[model samples]
Target: MHSVCVLGLGLIGGSVLRAVRSAGYPAWGATKSEGDRDAALADGYDVEASVEDALRRAADEDALIVLAVPLTALEEVLRQIRALAPSCPLTDVVSVKGPVAEAVGRILPSVRYVGGHPMAGSTESGWAAGSAELFRGAPWVVTAEEETDLTRWAQVARLAIACGAHVIPATPEQHDATVARISHLPHLFAAVLAAVGAEGGPLAWSLAAGSFTDGTRVAGTRPELVRAMCEGNRSALLEALDEALGRLGAARGSLASTGGLAVTVDAGHEARRGFTATPQAGPAEIRIDLKDPNALDELLDLGTLGGRITSIEDDLAVGEELGNP
Candidate 1:
């Protein structure tokens, strides 16, 4: 197993450290947060004295470096990586992929880097709130581009699998566009919904039920973190936001004219049902030979069709197609 070094020991970072360690891989982490550093150290995990120290060790060991920092902190972290471990195999758990990929390309063009985003998180923040099981069974995307190093990509995918996540191979553009709808848009909606409900005053707060709680849960995430995530993918988020507003406008107009929300309510209900419905048949197995010249293309195509890699054995990538036929 390739040793791992994680920079940023909060939430996702902390969880990655814990999960990788549990999987028997040698792992260590560093963070700028003194509280998180102390807490992780007290829990018996190796917490480096500083980012520089962590990077130096990673360089010496030729360990895979995982960037778990927020988008705002990404450039600074990348600069350190460039200085200390310019040639280390690298990956990240950042929420938005395009901007990170772009930054990496500009800053370390020759570095063996793969972008990743684990589609799992909590409304809570910080090291203490994270669990080793947070990513279990979640869809963790690994960006597959034309220039991606297959060996390094496989290493990153293996680590994700060992940490109990199914890997989704996607281009950074595809990942950003898709997540804008499923993830970032939801965060924005949650924020709006929470604010709107709160404006209903004390009576609304008293009558808050499961629907309200569930809908607004992500609105409770730290404001700075939410801002960084939503703002980082500006172009994609704008497109998703525009579509949402168009639907909302139509719904409002219908409600005002017809005094009925049937169209809006029914459409949402059907979409929700479709999302929750299980497949009647088992997923179809998919295999991609890593040595094939078209392997990266095949991986991206599989992800585009909602396939996920369960594991990689030697040169064979074993996956399954879960989307509708």
Candidate 2:
């Protein structure tokens, strides 16, 4: 097993570090907060005071370093990692992927960086709130770009699986587009609902129940974190918002007519039924940028990428598809 080290030991990162350590692999956490460092030390876990020191330790151990930080802090973190541990196989748990891949390309061109997003968390946060089971059975998305190193990509996927997550492979762009609708739009809607509920005065507070509280639970997440997430993938989020607004407008029109909202509500229910069970790992996919002349050669060299070539095309000409491996 590759040694594991996590940067920015917040909720997600701390949980990952704990999970990795519990799995019997050596793990270390790098934190800027002295309080957090002391707290981890008291818990009998390895903690580093600086990324430089952490990266140095990772370098010595040839560790897979997970950057579990905010989207805005990614570039600087990548820069620090590149300066200290240039050869480390790096991956991030940031929500957005395209922007992060772009940042990695710019800041750490030589380092191998795989993008990841674990679709797991609660309204809770901080190291104390971290749990080893947070990612258990969760859909852990691993974003592979055209230039992604397959070896490092597999390492990241294995790390996710070791954390008890189901690994799902996707391109950075596809991951962004899908999560925009499923994740980002819902967060916005929750905020909107919470805001409306807050404006309804004491009567609304008294009337609040399971439905209202459940719907608005995510709305209570840290404002700064939400802002960073929304801003990081603003383009995808805006597109998703437009689609959501269109559906809402249709629902409004139905509410005003004799047809009512039964169809709209039913459609949502059926769509949600598909998510009743945990999804299995679909397939291993490797996207090659045809724009590169040597891409075909690289594809031919990828021996164990067991996916069927259901669709063979570029990003501009055709869309990415999921098929058997």
Per-residue lDDT over 240-295 for candidate 2, one digit per residue giving the tens place of the 0 to 100 score: 99988888999999998876999789989988886563335554555655445654
Which candidate number has the best TM-score?
1
Residue 7 CA displacement from its true place in model 2, Å = 1.1
Prediction RMSDs, each to the true structure: 1.8, 6.8
Query: Worst lDDT window (10 residues) for model 2?
Result: 316-325
lDDT string for model 1 (1-325, tens) is: 7789999989999999999999999999999999999999999999899999999999999999999998988999999999999989999999999999999989998999999999998877889988899999999999999888888889999999999999999999999999899989999999999999989999999999999999999898889888988899999999999999999999999999989899999999999888889877779999999999999989998998878999999888899988462
Note the Cα lDDT for every prediction shown: 0.93, 0.78
Q: Name the best candidate (by lDDT).
A: 1
TM values, all candidates? 0.94, 0.80
Model 1 segments more than 4 A misplaced:
206-208, 258-262, 323-325
Cα RMSD (Å) between model 1 and the true structure? 1.8
